[model samples]
Target: MSYFGDIYKGIKTLLTGMSVTGKYFITARKGAITQQYPDNRETLKMFERFRGEVVMPHDENNEHRCTGCQKCEIACPNGSIEIIWDRQIDEETGKKKKMIDQHIYHLGMCTMCGLCIEACPTDAILWAQNYENSVYDRSQLTKVLNQSGSKLKAGVED
Candidate 1:
């Protein structure tokens, strides 16, 4: 309660804080718990469940499973997904069928929410582990999920 007593208490508290910092400083020589980012780039790995980005998986023949149902586009809160499709006549049946022209994913607008992945009925879209998504231009963030000349696999329906 006294002025000197209060001053002494403050000094003690300061010293206590300093002691913890000094302890860490001394122990840091043994091995730093903090990772040196660029140095650890080779060994660093992201977690399995980490939601980095949305991607469409394709088979060996470049055939994707996306039905272009627009579920992912609707589920996205930020409108990060855009499904561009067209009706084509199937040669076998001669029936008009919806085929995905392009599945555009805007990485810059994405919030890393897994709603799009969950909304995909055909399990077309999934979260990829590659987290580094930085780019100089915003236009570069808009990615087409399907590879060039890729097509839907046989029997994938809307």
Candidate 2:
């Protein structure tokens, strides 16, 4: 009797799952939740809050907001972010200040956790919307966020 009861329960559960799938299949033509990729690429849009990749925004003057504080680097759990910095004299204040030489991001190791963005005091880095990050070479995943000859924005250190 118990063996038959187990079989009956298993069949019931299977049918229940099938019914849900059947309903979706029946309505799929009307309004399917599944997206048709490549064909609908032009119409596709990612959500605003989607975390794609980390990027540093530079202004028209090639100035960024990063103060070389290293908070973002410290917040990263996987050591995906590396900030190469050096102390230089600030022309405005005549005081030595930390400036970043390179802001490196290893996309291969990043989990897209957004902790680095949150830890930044100057909002130096944020998520980019471009999600097409596939590459043939693993070394290509390593990116320098800061542009060459880019300097820290004035007053960002204060």
Candidate 3:
């Protein structure tokens, strides 16, 4: 009786899987599930919530919002983010302030967890919509988020 019951359950599971596959197969001609890569690159659109890569946005004046808080680095489960920062004297305040020299992001080590973006207090970092990140050399994956000569945006408090 147990053997017959087990066989019945197996058949039910198989039929359930086949039904899902058949449904997709029937609709495959009308609307294909997968897109044709390279050819449809121009028409391809990613979902809004898709996490591609971490990026720091700089404005026209070459200013960023990152205050070198290192919160993103701390939140990262893996050592993918590295903030090289130092203390500098603010010309206006005339006091020592933390400033980021370089905000490094290693794409190869990133898990696309979005933790770093959440940890940022000033909304300095965000996920870039572009998904074409493939490269031949591993060194190309390591990126400096901040542009050259980019300074902290004015009025952005730490």
Candidate 4:
């Protein structure tokens, strides 16, 4: 009698587990409501919480918001940012000021962690919504943000 009761209890537990599995099998046929990645980009809406590419915004006057403080450089953990800056006299005030001599950012090494943006006191660094960054050559990924021909406006912080 005792042996019979043990077998009966085992059968009862197995049936209970199978019942749950069977229920889900039927419901799953109704089609998944989950979002499709990448392909559904046009239909998908990004939330405010999403953090993407880092962009250095230039104001209407062409002057950037960066003060060339080197705070972002110091804050970057991966040493991805190399800011070659020098002190120049502010033409308006005649006072020595920080000027961005050169700005280089390597996308291949960047972690996209937004630490650089957060370190910026003037809100110079912003995160853009573009995420499709694909390049064949590693050298192409190394971007010089500020160049001679296309300098980020003048009289930024200087």
Return the top candidate by TM-score: 3
Which one is best on lDDT? 3
Clash count for each candidate, listed in order shown: 0, 0, 0, 0
Q: Lowest summed lDDT over 10 consecutive residues: which window, candidate 3?
A: 28-37
Model 2 spans with C-alpha error above 4 angstroms: 1-30
lDDT of candidate 1 vs native? 0.88
RMSD of each: 4.5, 3.7, 3.6, 5.0
Deviation (Å) of 15 in candidate 1:
19
Full-model lDDT for every candidate: 0.88, 0.93, 0.95, 0.76
- Please write out the lDDT profile of model 3 over residues 1-158, one tens digit for every residue: 99999999999999999999999889889986788989999999888888999999999999999999999999999999999999999888999999999999999999999999999999999998899999999999999999999999998883
> Model 1 — which ten-residue stretch has the worst lDDT?
149-158
TM-score of each: 0.75, 0.79, 0.81, 0.66
Using TM-score as the measure, name the better of candidate 1 and candidate 3: 3
- Clashing residue pairs found in predicted model 1: none
Q: Candidate 2 clashing pairs? A: none
Candidate 4 lDDT tens digits, 1-158: 97999999999999999999989888986866677777887877666656665667665555666667889899999998989888888766799877887778888889988899889887877777765678788898887665453334454444
Candidates arranged by lDDT, highest first: 3, 2, 1, 4
Q: Which TM-score value belongs to model 4?
A: 0.66
Ranked candidates, highest TM-score first = 3, 2, 1, 4
List candidate 1 segments past 4 Å from native.
1-33, 156-158
Query: What's the C-alpha lDDT at position 107 in model 1?
Result: 94
1-158 per-residue lDDT for model 1 (tens digits): 69999999999999999999999889998867677878888898888999988899999999888877899999999998888999998777899988789899999999988999989888988889886789999999999998888877777763
